[model samples]
Target: MPEMGRLPAGTMGLAFEEAIRRLELRNRLAALFERWGYLPAATPIVDFYDVYREWVNPQHVYRFTDREGDLVVLRSDATLFLARLLGLQLSEISQPLRLWYAEETISHIPSNHPVGDTGFQAGAEYIGLPQGEADWEVIILASEALECLGLQDYRIHLGSRALARVLIEAEGQTWSKDLIRDIHRLSGPCWENLSANLRHQFQCIGEPDQIAQQLGPFASCPEAAFLLQSCDILRSAGLGERLVIDLNEVGLLSYYTGLVFKIYVPGYHEAVVSGGRYDGLLKKFGIEAPSVGFSLQQGLIEVLHGSPEPQAPPAAASGTSWLERLANARRRRAKGERVVL
Candidate 1:
């Protein structure tokens, strides 16, 4: 029998200092989003299993049957749940809907990942906007969020779902959905019979424009063309230095229909933030509109930000009366500071 009161594997409990730092990161990111006009929103922790299965692997979700005998799951992904919550309402709404969320997510995490089964996530979604301004805005906001969290030395790897598709087709190779799913992972089978030049291109990372130019004939594909255009626009907007072209970074979600990207910093093997445009996702819910967004995982941010410094304890009261000491402590606590009697 399983041990009682023992937390499951791949899960953790954050203590005082770690919990405080996590909250501080969340509040700062949320404040940044609000400053950009992305209003706050939330979704239920538990949602219909079907709502996520299309985008998330079934094994990665915590599933159970509801009282009605229908399938339900603890939310493994916030984007899908948020999409389901706002799909119908957004159909009648105008374009350029901006929203942000900070919440906890639960899932069956991989054994090798150095994180718990549950984690705090903070992110923003830009809905109803197309590639040009919306894409640039999201990238800028991502970099800005990292900087606000005191992460200055970070890299953003910009990939293209469109370009990846074109590259596969250009190789005259047919890939099953399962194969495409495993292509970027370590356990996946390698693509055999590929040319040396093709293999090199797959591993290539450089300026977006340089990669686009090197594509030569494959540049004619519509997806490649769109990627080239967007890259140019993003560079012209002054994000050129922080950005790099990475064709091999596939998104976890199959619905990522356009540009996809991830943010990495020193010392972390996994991405700190991941987001992209999914113009096709809203339509999956019967709502036809373009959408883009990014999520910053607090676990990774804490890794980069390190532990919070201990605050100095409140000075001892002198000859003040008991009532005065109590009132003084109350005043300090009211202003969101720690206090001691």
Candidate 2:
């Protein structure tokens, strides 16, 4: 075994410096949300497993047994919970509930993680709204948030789960619930390498050809002519070049039923932010309302941005200039600048 060192892997003296920069960025993010008229809200760290389960992927939520032996999960995602909230509060408000939140959420998605099962997330959701206006507003907010953070060279990738659903439902196919999930999840090489997962799920379902036909047009962004013929949702909610359509991007299976997307930094493998419209999500709460929302990956963003840390020297040793330095420190303190001990 090796002798102990000063810091652990994924932990370091630099992380402290990184945290300060992220904290500053967080404050700016909040101001943007406020200006957009999306009031802030917070959900509990631990919440009803069923509430989260109904709209969050099983792999994403961290489940455990409490001391009382009851099953509970740390809240994995905030958008779904907010959807449920708007449903219950529907009568209290009018159409298109606009709300935003800047809070930490827990995600077990990453395989190798350190102590923090937690992630700092900030996002907004619009409820009781349909595709056009509701979605555009969220997209604009996403763009603004990135601009506020001074991020450029990012693109918003768009797709519709409706196309995926339409494909599965088209052939009058009767796939098991889980198969529908896999087909919606696996893509490209994974879909081929992991066809085994889909085999059993496809057993009760019909031949594969029927499935391909509905998925054909969507496999690539629907042809321009086809997109022009899309429903009001896609019609009024036109996607631009920066906001591209992949048709195959089946994101967030647990909640989204249509119009899913993610914002990708030019070089990163995973999206910086991903979300979509889960109009049916609120129905599980006994209210039928359309909703859309997304969550930002704070840690990932910090990594990409290489957020700088404060690098103040330790208090200077006593010297002829010590008095002058002390006076300077006092002046900085008066203006709210920190004085490192």
Candidate 3:
């Protein structure tokens, strides 16, 4: 039997100081996102399993039959639920919805997985805008969010599913999830048998100009053209040194139809943020709007930021009554200061 007070296998509990730091980090990111005009949004923690069964692997979802005899799942992916919610309820809203969410997602993981199943994600979604500016905005916002978190040395690994698809078709090989994953990891037994040109294409990674030169004839492809344009835009916006165009790193999500990216910090081996364009994801829920977004892994951020020192409450106002002190504390809090009554 499990120990009485022990948490579940893939769950974790944060103590007071760590929890407070996490809350502060969320608040900082929230302020940054709000400044960029993203309104807060949320979805139910429990949702119909049928909605996501097609996109998600069954083994990775925590599902059970509800009282209504319908299978349901603890939210495994926030973007999936948001796509359904926006499609079903807010479809008639004006075009180009800018929304953000900070929610906990629970999923089942194999024993070897590094992190727990329950994860907190803070993200922003830009829907309805066409690929160009929308892509630039989210990618830049992601960089700003990292800066807000005091992470100065980081890099964004940018890739495009569209470009990958075009390249695969050119080589006469059909694209599959397994193939994409293998390419992303640069592994698998099939790697030895791939054509030399295909192998060289996958090896193409560097600054935008270097990638364009290496792409040779493939650079003229529409998808590749868009990607190069995006790189130029990002460079113009002062992200030139930080951007790395890596064609081999295609998106992990099945719905990603355009550019995909992952942000990495120095000490971390996994991505701190993962997202990209999923123009077709909304169509799965009966809406047909272009969409792109990125989700920041709060746990990973916390690990990178380390445990923050507990804030000391403001000093008590001298010669003030209890009521006056309370009022002053309230005012300080309103101005975003830590206070204790």
Candidate 4:
């Protein structure tokens, strides 16, 4: 029988070897981000409820009232918090600052969902950069990170919120919050009826050039023209095969101002990686810089990449007892050499 206070569902406790592997993976990812000039950063785990409510679904956040009676939440996403943390200092920094982060985020899933309550996310933000190359840089970095984790069968699905919104606005429809929400959910009769023709074009996902050819007729639409041009650029950079353009795909976060993407592997239905450009988010934080970034779920990597390779057992000292080995280990530690007893 299970104990009265057994570990909760949708949570996990990793053992020694697995824990070490996770640590090593994090170290390698941090090293990679540093090599790309993204300085490491961290933010408080808990933030004001309003911060998350503005950008994400409030129901998914773990919330509580502090002693002062102000509502707070366990952060569901780091990108928004990062913006809030650094926004005030934008005037003091050089243009195009790159920031990287590795942290645990909490989400309260519905009872029927199989997702975990906690997950580790690693990501980077390129601030003060514009849409084209900066967006490509973040997407390529995300793909590279997935490759580093041995997930070769993954595909990146790309979309543009700015394009979608422009198309809707072109129809002269009044901006409807409910309609936007329906679009993101990709469901409901409203979106289905309104997005009929656009959905057909959006579903034409394939190599960038091929999609561009199909979208060329709509070149009169500035957003479509930009999207088509971006596609050619991505193809020139050799990402045509690995990328899928989904015009109907909507941004997961309300703040995603421009291009947005999600990474999907063969076996997992959910995105293992997600990110986008949010040029307008900084303005909300009292800053006016554009930014782009992505978050990789470490837990998903562990699941998809499988267990790390086994390491050989440490050799025992030929002429020393356990006590002598401990003493030797202490001596080595004193000399700055790492020793495992």
Best by TM-score: 3
Error of 3 at 264 (Å): 1.0
Q: Between candidates 2 and 3, name the one with more favorable TM-score.
A: 3
Please give, for residues 1-341, the per-residue lDDT of candidate 3 as tens digits.
Answer: 65887987899878878888888889998999999999999899998999887788888889999999999999888999999998788655457889999889899978798878988998999999879899999999999988998888988888999998888888788788778767877777555556788878887778888898888898998999999888888978978769889887689878899999998888786899998999989988988789999999988888887667876756664326888878888888888876776
RMSD of each: 2.7, 7.1, 2.8, 3.0
Tens digits of per-residue lDDT for model 4, 156-216:
7888878777767766654455666777666666567665666566556676566666665
**If both were scored by TM-score, which would come out higher, candidate 2 or candidate 4?**
4
Per-model tally of clashing residue pairs: 0, 0, 0, 0
Q: Candidate 2 residues 1-341, lDDT tens each?
A: 35475443333333566767777778888899888887787766776676666556677677887888877887767776666566566644456667777666776655475324566778888777877667767876887787788787777766556665554455454434464455555543434433342332322222223333434454354422232233223324543345554544556555677667688887666688887788777777777778888778766777777647467854533335868767777776777776532
Q: How many clashing residue pairs, candidate 4?
A: 0
Off by over 4 Å in 3: 1-3, 189-193, 311-341
**C-alpha local distance difference test of each model:** 0.79, 0.63, 0.86, 0.78
Q: RMSD (Cα, Å) of candidate 3? A: 2.8
Candidate 1 — which pairs collide?
none
Which candidate number has the best lDDT?
3
Off by over 4 Å in 1: 1-5, 186-190, 193-197, 315-322, 330-337
Better of 1 and 2 by TM-score: 1
Clashing pairs in 2: none
**lDDT by residue for model 1 over 1-341, one digit each (tens)?**
56777887877778877877777888888899999999998989998888777778888889999999999999877888888888756664465789999888998978887787987788889998877688879988988998999988888888887777777767787645564565565234544445566666666678766787677787777777777677677777776667787876667677787888898888888899999999888788878788999988877788766667875666653337888988887877888866677
Model 4, residue 232: distance off in Å is 2.6
